[model samples]
Target: MIKNHLSQVFYCFIITIILVFNSCKDKINSENQTKTEQTEVSKTVYASSVIPFFDQWKLILGDGSNAGIATEFENKDFFYTQNDGKDNWVVFKSPNGGDTHGTSNNTRTELAQTKKWYPKTANDKLSATLKVMNVSATGDATVAASHSVVVGQIHSADAFENEPLKIFYKKYPGHTKGSVFWHYEINTAGDDNAKRWDYSSAVWGNDFSVVGSDVSTFPEEPKEGIELGEEFSYQVVVKDGIMNLTFTSPNHETKTFTKNLLLSEYTTKSDIPEQTKKLFFPIGQDGVERSEAYAGEGCFFKLGCYNQTNGKSPEVNKNWCSGAETHGGDIQKQYADGNYAEVWFKTGSISVSDTAVSNDGYFAKND
Candidate 1:
């Protein structure tokens, strides 16, 4: 009887052990399956994706008489020109005293035109390449000065009423020597009239003196001389009231700049009744005049835009004050507007070998 009881006990113990081991095996298998499924899903979602946006436009500026009658137009098909005859005239986006002579009729003209085309989606990103070719210029050259290329909004009257983002480059005989200069002016039409904030050589000069009651409320200028070039890729991204500007070189080196101004800042104070919401890209301070003194010769350039948005995102509000708030969203909208973001090319008797555009990029939106 005792032997029989011991056998029964042994068998029961073995059975219990077997059951526990099988249960554990099942649990392990289930866990592994779940992990594998998750990995597959992640791979499926993150595969390379294509985002569509408008590509850059090719523009031509020519002298009317010798280049003949150059007719420039911008539409869905292409941004182009037909030259008449004269080839001695130089093309300019920003003309200074000496360089003005080369411009037809000594008047700054828009060689291309664009219509408004907003994206259907919000929070999208866009990018493009700006190629500035040195066409030709004439006469007495001095120190080559830098040229300014800008990307901003244009108001109803075609006036550069709003503060547009700008990039400045210096032109020398053989070397390109210039840095990006980013400037912002708040309450521009009010008691703060023309009170500007610059993040360029201003830091080097340490001068914040400007016309405004709250000139005392200015922030210290950030670092300047961030270099950019042909081999470098420049990109801007905007989402949910944030603006991120990035520059990547061929070697994969990247530098980023960011700023967050609030939407309320876009509003005008009761003191400035003339202020209105407008977007603009005026030739920056470093046009042909400055280049003549700095660059040994002059330069000519072109502007382009890439639009990538489906409109599912939020529409850009002109009243939004802070580009930081909209993330990269505002910059994306500017590109989608079908306008060539303003950029200056150099041509003439000067050399702008080392001129570079600034990385002062931004986005704007509310909430």
Candidate 2:
């Protein structure tokens, strides 16, 4: 009787162990299924869909890859969106170095408006509300990394090889405030742009040329400066052959500047202003200008985080080519090492000719 009872208890113990094992296995499988479902559902929304003005814009990441104009898209390593407690914002990101387009050595994850228009059009407008997030911190304080990201631009589509406008936000390593500035690329009085340089204007802080005496030194922060994640808005209007630019923020003054894009303003070296002379003194870039600059050139607009940092030797040009860190194409390594630039756009809108056409064959193109 005792042996029989022991046998019965042993069998019961084995049965209970099998039941527990099966229960745990089922739970693990269930959790994996749920996680898979959540991932699938989250992919339904994308940058082009959630962000406004996406219909007129397409994305190109730092690696020079993109999904053809589509509403559903996401690049894991570059362009995407994230919520910041208050709201969701489209995020543009790029490594310090990666595959690039054109003659530019810098890499960016930015948006290009598919539409093309002349700067002389009756009225072409582009506007956006954005904030700077991060720039590569590994570059020389005087170089482009100092201004890690360019939020917007007016790029020439023809042979001019010109970016008439580039809006920039720059910050120092330990400073509490960054700067808001814009650059004016020379339309160069003639086709010989070999000697041209951008003329920067301060919107709320020191212009791009305000560098420290040495790489380790830093200039005084602007009396009225901008900080990372501080929201701001800008509007670019090209009407009557002139470009009107406006920058605004809640704490900063509303600043405006009007430039004639169709005509050449710098026709000669003497035409350069005193401020420009002082600013560009180091580079010795002062050169003669052509008579007809950027006239009759096709122009378009671009928006996103265009990184200004590179791995080039700082000894070559500490101001523009500081030896910033680059992790090759290892994106995960780059991000972990903080070798990337990031920008955020909360709102945006675009306007072209009423002709309903753009560079891409959309309604405006057919019209």
Candidate 3:
């Protein structure tokens, strides 16, 4: 009987020890999982994380300042990451009524990457997948914004005040359709901004030159246009002085365009517009146009929401008045109330190499 009692006690003791050991191990694992969650929440997702060749680019915020050299993942307020239940996205936002870079009333949260190339530089490409969310709503409805936001730009880094390309998305109020257009800003021969004007081209609808005379009017609706939240992509390939653009959509047709950046088509007096002739005639800018164009200028690329909206009312000037509403520079309220521009990019790449880049996603599974 004594032996039996001792044996039972021994079995109970062994079981008690085993249970305690298992419980502690489970607690440790639980703590570790919690820590992992917190860590992920602390870190920000970056364009480099989502796109290929992120190291080759740098970010510039709306205030005409560099976000950084692109080493850090994010800038606190101007640039950051957001997840919309399906995927993580890099958000570029800027206010309508704000300070701007030279010769621009609009502000931008954009990324710029310089390439060692001239006007006739070839085999350089920049591509991205993105969508534009909102633009300024208080401007003249008859102007470009009845609804419009600039989504992409190709700017010259040299002293020439020229932009090789500017991509625009515009929609009218109380409509579901919108248009996509691009413009090539003329290199005004010298630093004379008064003699500058852009040559507009159409991708999905009317070009930059198509606009209503007054704030209450709007251009014709684009028969085939992309709506807000619709995902689209654009690829810019500069080869031998010709800029070849390819725009794609999941449900829409894929379109391509080509332009010559080496030669200036608007180099003569007749090329000057009647509007610039009337307005700038007093300034004596009618006889000046870029003779060689953007040739040999070290041009750069910029991508982001360059808010086309301004504080001026449509009643003020149909051309410059975005007449959109403003929230007194309150970024939080503006973001929440849809008073600003927001753009998202899933993936992008810049290939300076002469070889073609593959379409494979480097961080496809990271989401």
Candidate 4:
């Protein structure tokens, strides 16, 4: 009987030891797995991580939702991050017909800088390395703004609220290459908005005035223009009321332009260019810029895909209206049909003039 009791006690002790050891081992393994998952999550990249300057800007999505502080924000349909096997990119997408800004008829998934400054008081600069991934594929080819997207701008915040600069990328359907251009809208002298016009200049290929002859007929493709998915960079620096622009791309010539904001280039009726007369005159847009162009007015920077395509009747304004197929503002249907614009930015920054920059930094600093 004594031997039997001793053997039973021993067996019980051994079983308890085994159970405790297994429990401890399972707990350790679970802890290690949790740590690994935490590390992976911490290393994940977001749109804010790609563009650190989001702290200084607010976002407006294509669905009309606005975000003030978007430190780690993204929407799969409008603004999000993408990895192209090489590196991650921040994408801005918008459909042709959807929610729009109160002051405009276009839809956008864009960032607007929160800080506004006067050109004479501050030297603000915005730079970016980007590519136009896609644009509205279906539109009236004769419309100049059709099938185009504005990637960057310096928008006014004062009277009339005109845009001082709008960098545009336009590609026609069935064309392999696209054109890069910029437009400077004049600050109209009077209250009528109908008289305002934009003066456009081309960085690569034809300017905004080069449109198709008719709705279906297309123009010759720009021989040296940029293609879809091609990378390019631009810098806009406003120093002492003078605007300086620089555009650079791989395998293309670098272009630079300068404009004086304190002085007016179009103070009289005859100061209009031939391109503007031919493009805007028939539409009764013949206004001239004020003497002190954009001076003392508060302005902010905007970056993203400001889709220019709309569903308006082209007969009303052939130059501005696109009359694209909208499918009654259905976003998913528009996306499936390639009736949207998408722009991807690899890197970008907005800085004041006095900001220090490393010599080998990606953003090109204008001395």
Among the numbered candidates, top lDDT falls to: 4
Per-candidate TM-scores read: 0.33, 0.85, 0.77, 0.86
Write the residue-wise lDDT of candidate 3 on 18-132 in tens digits: 9999999999999999999999876757656666465665566776565544654676556776777887777788877565655566677877663445656556788888887
Task: Supply candidate 2's per-residue lDDT for 176.
Answer: 78
Tell me the spans in candidate 1 whose CA falls farther than 4 Å from its real position: 1-124, 134-148, 151-160, 173-177, 187-192, 201-229, 263-367
Number of backbone-clashing residue pairs for each candidate, in the order shown:
79, 7, 7, 0
User: Ten residues in a row with the worst lDDT in model 2?
Assistant: 358-367
TM-score of candidate 3 relative to the true fold: 0.77
Question: By summed lDDT, which 10 consecutive residues of candidate 1 come out lowest?
Answer: 358-367
Q: What would the per-residue lDDT of candidate 4 be over residues 110-227, giving only the tens digit for each residue? A: 8877667778776889999999999998889899989899999998766777898999999998899999999999988867877999999999988999998888888899998999
Task: Report residue 63 deviation for candidate 2 (angstroms).
Answer: 1.9
Q: lDDT (CA) for every model shown?
A: 0.26, 0.76, 0.69, 0.87
lDDT tens readout by residue for model 2, 263-343: 777877788877667645466656655555666777778898888888887666545676777876677787887788888
TM-score for candidate 1, residues paired by index: 0.33
- Model 3 regions more than 4 Å off: 1-44, 75-77, 84-86, 272-288, 313-318, 353-367
| Residue 287 displacement (Å), model 2 | 3.5
